[model samples]
Target: MTVQPTEPTTPRLEWFKSSYSTGNGGECVEVAAAPTHVHIRDSKWPSGPMLTLGPGAWASFVGLIAD
Candidate 1:
């Protein structure tokens, strides 16, 4: 996984929060994905730095963390 900075020319991505997230403010993250990359950011900051990963990396991460 890599940290990616949002560029001025970066296209708008469809970001979604975790289903486990309640409506109330809490520690959470949002994700957006493209065919080649996955993006993750703090739910509280849309314009903040993002963690970008290749599809394989994302899958590996999910596998490691998922129950």
Candidate 2:
């Protein structure tokens, strides 16, 4: 039997783009907040793929990058 993945039942996410985004055309990153996870996407393609990571994982990623 073919298995179909269940869709996200979570409510709509509130996406926010970085303030550093250039007013002109350029690449940027967008992020969204979920109850237990964070969603990341490319600002260049709002409808593009998203990378979802746990809150802890996101925090660690940020800490590492900030170091």
Candidate 3:
């Protein structure tokens, strides 16, 4: 038996910073959405590493954080 690992291709994403973010120096994040995943990165570091989550997982995470 042979095993192969499948890697997801990087998609061109249009990222936007959180609306709550102000120009002042503060911790903020940016988000981009693809058909099957959501990407998150630090607002201050646009070219930094990103965190990816599936649609369902993203929804669940948002639900947990919503007020």
Best candidate (score: lDDT): 1
TM-score, one value per model: 0.78, 0.75, 0.77
lDDT of 2 at 6: 90
Backbone clashes for every candidate come to: 0, 0, 0
Per-residue lDDT of 26-65 in model 1, one digit per residue for the tens? 8588999977899999999888899999999999999998
**What is the C-alpha lDDT profile of model 3 across 3-42, one tens digit per residue?**
8997768767898888888879775789999988999999
Candidate 3 at 53: error in angstroms? 0.1
Off by over 4 Å in 1: 1-10
Tell me the whole-model lDDT of each prediction, alpha carbons only: 0.90, 0.88, 0.89
Q: How good is model 2 by TM-score?
A: 0.75
Residue pairs with colliding backbones in model 3 are: none
Off by over 4 Å in 3: 1-11
lDDT of 2 by residue, 33-64 (tens): 88889999998888889999999999999899
In order of lDDT, best first, we have 1, 3, 2
Residue pairs clashing in model 1 are none
